[model samples]
Target chain A: MKITIIGSGNAATVLAKLCVQQGHSIVQIISRNEEKGKNLAQNFNAQYIPLNGTVNKNIEIVLVAITDSVFPKALDGLNFGSIPVFHTGGAVSMNVLRNTTTNYGVLYPLQSLSAEVEEIPTIPFLIEANSENSFKILNEFANTLSNNVTKVLEFKRLRLHAAAAIANNFTNYLYTCAKTYCDNEELDFNLLKPLILETANRIQNNDPEKVQTGPAKRQDVYTLGKHLQLFSEYPKLRTLYTRMTESIMHG
Target chain B: MKITIIGSGNAATVLAKLCVQQGHSIVQIISRNEEKGKNLAQNFNAQYIPLNGTVNKNIEIVLVAITDSVFPKALDGLNFGSIPVFHTGGAVSMNVLRNTTTNYGVLYPLQSLSAEVEEIPTIPFLIEANSENSFKILNEFANTLSNNVTKVLEFKRLRLHAAAAIANNFTNYLYTCAKTYCDNEELDFNLLKPLILETANRIQNNDPEKVQTGPAKRQDVYTLGKHLQLFSEYPKLRTLYTRMTESIMHG
Candidate 1:
């Protein structure tokens, strides 16, 4: 497949690398900035083109891997000449591509991605298309890059995206808060690493609520109160601790 | 070391297994129930003694691996004849053993433990003692079971305990909430496993605050609001989502 990848950011870079490694040709690299565009193009052995520049008509798929804010204006004054165009985003609706081209789709990776990672782990790709033919093409292309691919439509995909936010983003925030508390007390944050890994590993084989063990889950009010008092220095964390404990205890 | 292990729960079971594997003699297994006590005792080829029964006077150390609530009453009226005694708990203070015996200490494993797990991973032990002699013995015993051991004091240990609650228990609760939301939508919870593993793995090498991603950290009010709206069907999760988002953004 001859692919043209747009945007020069983390998701874009990772997707481009996956495509090139999988024996697909990256026909062009498009970005608003010429320097980043040229750099990514050189790294992937593709040609550089500005966002407003002409997209190659010979390409098979044009992938837009830009941020949500930039996604709306992604195809402004651009033409793919009936080539299948796919935007990789979780929140945006598939209808946004209705005006871009007759053949448009979405290829959202269900993972918290980072460009610093050299090898992309096996990420589940959630895909959608406006038509069956486009869906088949996009799904086949996605399978080439990842084994875990699902052809979910827009509404269910959005709900899954929201759940992913809570699971990945909210949990990482708690980790940040925990590390902050450890730092303030002059304790080694390193000590909490094994517990964190074990906690995550437990959920692999059991329901998280059933396997929950701690001051909050066991209703150890004495220890919970002590933790609250400790978090008095940070009002936000104190509030968070109270709310989450109540949720766990009551729900 | 001639060791007598008290209780038959997760901590006690793991500790007994570790001691036996290290070629230490389990002099006795003490519990209120004869069945569980004898079961554990027979597993290690040690004598089973009821909580009120006479303990062997020749034992070198008595380890109380019981719940925090029952820890206060664990050694009441039981004479150890100056044998070094230790309890494994995180939130507990070393002073709890002050009235129990003259030679008392703490041997806490800083990891989420389960009785169902057959093999214990390399867990970091947090040890404290009333005196230097007790500390040396406990440290050596702890080193036999685990490579990572720290002699953390009561105050700092309490802080670490609170941080562990947030990192392990609170995050598992968040995972439970996320899984609940996914189940309601008829989505496969298996899709979350890879992301959960990757999120936990990232913190092993980087500062969690620096590597934190998602709508809450980005302060993307639009996606956050959408998630809040989705959670309106479940009031508890809705409240949790709002509080966590605020904490991540403001803290």
Candidate 2:
């Protein structure tokens, strides 16, 4: 497919590279900044477009892989003609691009994409479209890049995004809390890696409830009190620990 | 090394199997229950002793892989003569076996072991000893089973256990929360596998703080408020969401 990506950020760069590697022609690369636009465009051997520009009419798809806040404004003056327009955002709804063109949808890659990181091939992409024809086009487009593409509605995708926040974002915060605590105590954070890996691997076969273990889960109030007391030096961490433990024990 | 395994629980089973695979002679298998003792003992072709029976003095090392609560009481009656005794526990202090024997130590595998789960070859074992000679013996014993073994002190091991609780136990709870939420909403929990795997893999190279993302970390009050309201049915989950969001925002 002849594709045009409407962003030059991490997600845009990574997706562009992957699409190019998959033998898709990137017709144009769009960005507000000319330099970033040119950089990505040069990599994919596509045309670079600044703000207040239009996508190629011949391109099969126009992927609006930009920030949520700027997406609507960025598409205000742009025209994709008959090409399908899609945004690569989890939280943002597909309707955000409804006004941009008749053929609009969402092409969200459900993974943390960073330019510095190696590309992951099997990320589940949640595709949504305003119409059946557009849905097929987006679905087929996603199929070429990944095997794990699912056509989900906007509401279901939103719920999935919320759950992702809990599992990915909130869990990462717990890791950050652990790392901070370890750093302050002059402990080796690397020692926690095996535990992290094991916990994750356990849930692959067993339910998380069945595999749960700790002071809170075991109801070991003495160790819990000790852990809470130790957290007094870090007030924010103490609050988090207290709240989390209380939720686990009482809830 | 001639080794005798005490208790036939998950840790003991895994350790016994690993030892047997390493061509070590398992002199005997001891458990409070005769059935489990016999079952484990049969695997390694070693003698199975009932709780009322005597210890095998022929064994050079006795590994007391049992629960934390009964560890002290169990050690009180055991008579291993001059044999080196070691307990596999993280939070239990080395002093628990002080009066029982002079040659005592700790050999804590820093992974969540289960009898049903297939054994992993490279588990990080935390070794601690009451004396230099005991430590040397435990070190040599650990090197035979796993390549990654650390001679950690009791105090440091305690801190590492706390870190493990955060990274493993707390993180698993978050996963449970996500799964529960997904099930309640009739969404496929399998969709979360990629996100979970990626989150774990990212920590291999980047710090959790640097890779952290979501509405909470971004301080998007609107999305956080929406999520909290959506979680009103699950009061405990709601509290957790609110508290975690506050921690990430302030931290």
The candidate that achieves the highest lDDT relative to the unseen native structure: 1
Please compute DockQ, using alpha carbons, for every candidate against the native two-chain complex.
Answer: 0.71, 0.60
- Model 1 residue runs over 4 Å out of place are A33-39, B25-27, B33-39, B42-47
**Ten residues in sequence with the least summed lDDT for candidate 1 chain B:** B113-122
Which prediction has the highest DockQ against the true structure? 1
Error of 2 at A123 (Å): 0.5
Per-model TM values vs. the true structure: 0.93, 0.92
List model 1 lDDT by residue over A163-223, tens digit each: 8888888888889988988888788999999989988888888888777888777788888
Candidate 1 lDDT tens digits, B1-251: 89998998778888898888888989899998789889999999999999889878788888888877675787687766567889898878777777766888999989887766666766889999999888888888889888999999988888898898889888898899889988898988888888888888888877888878777776778777777777788887787778777777888
Q: Model 2: residues >4 Å from true position, as ranges? A: A33-39, A69-71, B33-39, B42-52
lDDT of 2 by residue, B79-165 (tens): 766578899978788878777677999999887776767755358999999889989998998999888898888777877777777
| Residues A30-98, model 2: lDDT tens digits | 899789889999988899988777556787888888865564777777766667888998878788787
Residue pairs in candidate 2 whose N, alpha carbon or C atoms collide under 3 angstroms: none
Model 1, CA-based lDDT:
0.85
